[model samples]
Target: MQTLHYLTLSVLIPPLLSFFAEPGALFFEGGATNVGMIMDWREMAGRPTVRGMQGEDRWNAYYGAWSGGKQLGSGWVEGMWDGRTDPMRGWVIAFSWMFASFADIYYLCILVRRPRLLLDFALTLGFSHIVLTTYYSASIPTSLFFWIVMFTWSATTVTIAEQICVKREMTEGLVISPPRDEVDDLEMGELLRRD
Candidate 1:
């Protein structure tokens, strides 16, 4: 369950955030740099350092900072401090949806116990992704359909897990073990335990 939650957030959150917030804003406005920060630290280290806004600055920050610049004709080290390229909205949506779908399928395989149930859920999930990929529509009805499938899958997994747990509990105390000592065959065919 926790795995499901984490996978959901990781696969959904970043692109959703990018929709509203500028990618640059997602990072510090005045970028900070330090041994740790330059080392890709997300938080302040022992010492605090501040970096100016990332863009086509004298330091040529944009080249490394913006995929826009990287994807365009800008050289690997050149900075595009002045402007941004196309957001590639369609590609972003497509990739995000596909990635989330893949993650869900992988996690479902791990969570579901019964092979038949797993196959059913997996087929449903694959179809849902196909609908999404084919339409690329965010209409309310489409969104609702996606959520419904997701919820149903979650419910089924929980129910199956509970059933398994209950079964294990019911049989736990009734488990039988073989005799610890060796057993020998008697003349009449009955087995006798040897001390």
Candidate 2:
């Protein structure tokens, strides 16, 4: 049950955050002919062309943004920083994924409250990323940059969560004392013996 909860959150939260952050990536653009229809809900709901892909082609490009895949372009470093191309959008998306990772880790720490389990949680998140990317793209993601980003996300999350949990544990002291009844009985016995 705990594993199910961890895996579900590990797979779901980051992508949900990405969707909220970059909703424009999910819509089909009609170019100059439909300049006024840019934010059409109908387009977003149906099989919208993502990054110039349509219908079945979109499946090959459905890499999750949380996994370092961009809807507008290739999420790989080579695609983002190609020698004559502007890389601003790619960098922004990457940072957003990192930010989402922070939130995900923080929430997990609060819920699980076990520092030792953080590594396992982080691994689950990384595995989910690989599975999602592979499933969506229909091929193994061989991009070095993608794997690096995924590793960075997992490492950073575990490190920060551990730090936070350790600090919290240190600050929260446990109080251990004898029962009130035992204390009273000892006090009465001492009084009787003295008299």
Candidate 3:
């Protein structure tokens, strides 16, 4: 659990600080770099019109998805992100991660045994980005935030699984062999034995 907590926080806290307190907006004012930011986002939404996409009225024809549930050019977008694209959008995305991280901190304090709660928190955080996106009027930052929460939650779940497996195995005093590629696993065995 200490390992999980440490790993979770490594990716968690900095983004939280950036989220609450705009990081480096001092220099990204509407300028060339900022223009690049706008271009980057448009290009992603612009792929449907590419030359090779001929006969493709919609990109959905390739993804096996219908246009109805598809979220197209309209949705919740954080108004705050538009004005300050570089640092602003960056900051909003960072804020989402920060919220996830802070939630992890809460999980550590309250749900150490009920790991399902940790998994739920991460998944909720990931999906929350979408809700927040809609609430913010459909924006790219929401997508980015979703990615952050997904990653954190996945990592937490993995750590929890490993810990549960290790505990179950240790009760029998069984010597489980480490994978061949995992040199670190040998050291982990020694460390776990000491515990």
What is the clash tally of candidate 1? 2
Stronger candidate by lDDT (1 vs 3): 3
Query: Which candidate ranks first by TM-score, i.e. highest?
Result: 2
Clashing pairs in 3: 75-137, 75-138, 76-137, 76-138, 77-136, 77-137, 77-138
lDDT of 2: 0.51
Residue-level lDDT for 71 in candidate 1:
36
Residue 12 of model 1 has an lDDT of 61
In model 1, the runs with Cα more than 4 Å from the true position are: 1-112, 137-195
Alpha carbon lDDT at 116, candidate 3: 48
On the 0 to 100 scale, the lDDT of residue 56 in model 1 is 50
Report residue 162 deviation for candidate 2 (angstroms). 0.6
TM-score winner between candidates 1 and 3: 3
Model 3 Cα lDDT, one tens digit per residue, 81-190: 22222334444334434454554555543444444455555556445544544443333532454455447655755465446645654665777666776968787898
Candidate 2 stretches with Cα past 4 Å from truth are: 1-87, 174-195
lDDT of 1: 0.40
Which candidate comes out best when scored by lDDT? 2
Better of 2 and 3 by TM-score: 2
Q: lDDT: which is higher, 2 or 3?
A: 2
